[model samples]
Target: MVINLSPVYIENSLLFANTLVMLAVGLTLTYLTTKVPNFAHGSLAMVGAYALFTIAAIMFGNQLSQLQLAQPLGLGFAAAFLAGAFAGLLEYLLVLRPLQKRGSTPLGLMIATLGVDLILLGVLNIFADILRGMNPVTGTTRDWRLKAYVIQKVAGLSLGVWISFGIMIGSLVALYLLLTRTRFGIAMRASIENPALAQVLGVNVDLVNMVSWILAGGFAGLAGGMMAFVQRINPATGSIEVVAVFAASIVGGLHSLLGAVVGGYVVGLSETLLTKILSDITGVNLVTYKRAVPLIFIIVTLLVAPEGIMGINWRRLFSRIRSRK
Candidate 1:
C-alpha cells in the first residue's frame, strides 16, 4: 500500500535538511582549516537563536510573543549571524588559539571545543531563563520561551522555510565563489591543503583560521535562528542535535564541504522520513527514535566507506564504466 506523504512532513524535512546543511558546512570549514571538529558549533546556533529572540524582545518589548507580523525579519537574521560570528571569534581567540599556541594536538583541540560547548550551553540556559521572564506578571496566553512568529506565508509555506532554503543555496553559492573566484578563497584553499606550505608561500594562516571560525559560527547562528522559527528553541536541545551535525559531516567526508552539504540533506531526510515510514508501517509512535537515525547513518558510512560521499573516486568509476561498455 502506498502511503501519501503530508506536505507538512515534506516541508519539515526540507527545512531541517537545509538547516543541517548550513551547520555541516560550517563544521567542515572549521575542520578543514583548523583540523579541529568543533563540538561547540551547535551551541553557537543556540546562541544565535537566543540572539534572534533578544532582537525581537528589543523591537517588541521584553515579550517576543507580542511581536507583530509587520516586524522586520531582516534585523533578526543579521543579529543572529553577527552574534554567532562574534561568539566563534571569541572562542577561537580565547580558547582554541591559546591551546594551539601551547602545541595541543587535534584530540586536545577537540576536547577544548567540548569544554567550550559546555560553557556556552550553561550561558545559553541562563540567557533563556532571562528571556522567559521577559513576559509580564499578568497571565497571558502567549509564551515567550516558545515564541514562534510564523504568519507571513508564501504560497502556503512559511517565510522561514523560504529564507532558510534561500540561505542554504546562497551560502553554498557564495562558498563556491569564495573558494574558486576570490584571492582570500584561494588562500583559504591553500591553507586547508597545506598550511605549512601556504604559510611559507606568504599566506597568513592565522588570519585564515580566524576567518574560517567567524564564517562557520555565522552560518551556525543563521541555522539556529531559522530553526527557532521552524521549531521550539531551548538550551537543552542545543547539544542534543550536534550528533546529527557530526553525522552529516562524517557522511559527507569531513574534509569535503561538498560531501557535508550532501550528507546533511541525506541525513536530514532520513531522520524525518525513516521515523515517519516506520511509524506508519508499525502503527506505533517511532518518532522518539529519530535521533538514532543519524547515528545509524554514521555507523553505516563508517562501515561502508569511512571517507564518505565525496571520498569516492568518481573518475575511477567513470573509467571502469567506459571499459565495461
Candidate 2:
C-alpha cells in the first residue's frame, strides 16, 4: 500500500474537513427544528462568508490582511462569526418562520428557502461587483490571486487551516456540553424530538428555533470565514462546498449530532486522500470531477450503510443504551 501523501494534501484535507463539519452542523439544526432537508443551508453559509468578508475588510483593511476576530483572535473572525449567526437568524425570520406560520409543509419551506438562496446569491453578486469597483481587484469575488490572505500560524499549525479545525472541535465540544448539561439543551432536544410535547411542557418552540437558527448560522459563517482565504471564494463558493457537506452529514447519520462531525472528517479524508490517488490512477483529468469525489463517497455510503456509519438505530444507541449487565 503505497500512500502518496504530502503536507499540501494534509492542509487541503483539513480545510475540506472543517468545511464539511460546519455544513453538517448547520443542516442538523434545520433538520432538528423543522424536519426538513434544506438545500438553502448552503446558501446561508455562502452569504455569511461574504458578510464576514465585508466586515473584516473594514476591521483589517490591509493592516494584517486577516482579522482573527477580537484579541481572542481578532475583530474580523468575531465579526464573521457573528455575521453568520445573523444570517441564520435572518433566514429563519424571512423564510422559515414566515412559511412555518402559515402551516407550510417541510417541502414548501425547502422550496421557499431555495428561492431565498438564489435571491441572496444574486444580491451578493451585485455587492461583489460594487466591491470590485471600489477595491478594484482586491477581493475573492474578483480575481483568484489579487493579494495574499490568511495568517500563517496560530498557537501552532497554519492558523488559517487549523482555525477551522479548532472551530469544529470547539463547536462539537460546546454542543456536547449544551446538549448534556443544560436546561436549554434539554428543551432543545425535546423540541427536536417532539415540538408539541415541548410546547406542552412550557418550552417556547418559536424562540428556541430562532436561537438554533442563529447558532447554526454563526457556526457555518465561522467555517466559511475560516476557509475564505484557504480557498478562492466567490458568491457561488458555498454552492461548490455543498456536495462535500451533505455527503458527510448523510454518512454520519441524518439526524445524529456526533455523526455529523464524524461524517465530515471521513468525507474530508476521502476527498483529500482518495482524490490524490484517483487523479494519478485514471489520468483522465480529475479536475472536471474533483468535486464529485465526495458525491461518489456519499452515494456509496447511502448504498452500503443507508443508516450511516453511526448506525440507523440512534434511539437505541444514543438515547436508550439498555441496562448494563
Candidate topping lDDT: 1
**119-182, model 1: which lDDT tens digit per residue?**
9988987786766656422222122332245535678986667778887898789889999999
Task: Quote the positional error of residue 93 for candidate 1 in Å.
Answer: 1.0
In candidate 2, what residue range of length 10 has the lowest lDDT sum?
142-151
Residue lDDT tens for model 2, 1-325: 3446677567767777887788898787777787767676766676666766666555554555355344424455577668778877888898778888899998898788778778767877897777664432244554432124544555555666666667778877887888779999899999999999999999999888988888788887777776675676787777668777788889987878778888888887777766777766766545466678778878898898887878866566655666432
lDDT of each: 0.83, 0.73
**What would you estimate as the lDDT of candidate 2?**
0.73
Each candidate structure's TM-score, on Cα atoms with residue i matched to residue i, is 0.89, 0.85
TM-score of candidate 2 relative to the true fold: 0.85
What lDDT does candidate 1 reach at residue 66? 32
* Clashing residue pair totals per candidate (backbone < 3 A): 1, 7
> Candidate 2: where is the Cα deviation over 4 Å?
1-3, 61-73, 136-140, 143-147, 151-156, 281-288, 312-325
Write out the backbone clash pairs for model 2: 68-73, 68-74, 69-74, 69-77, 69-78, 70-74, 70-75
Clashes of 2: 7
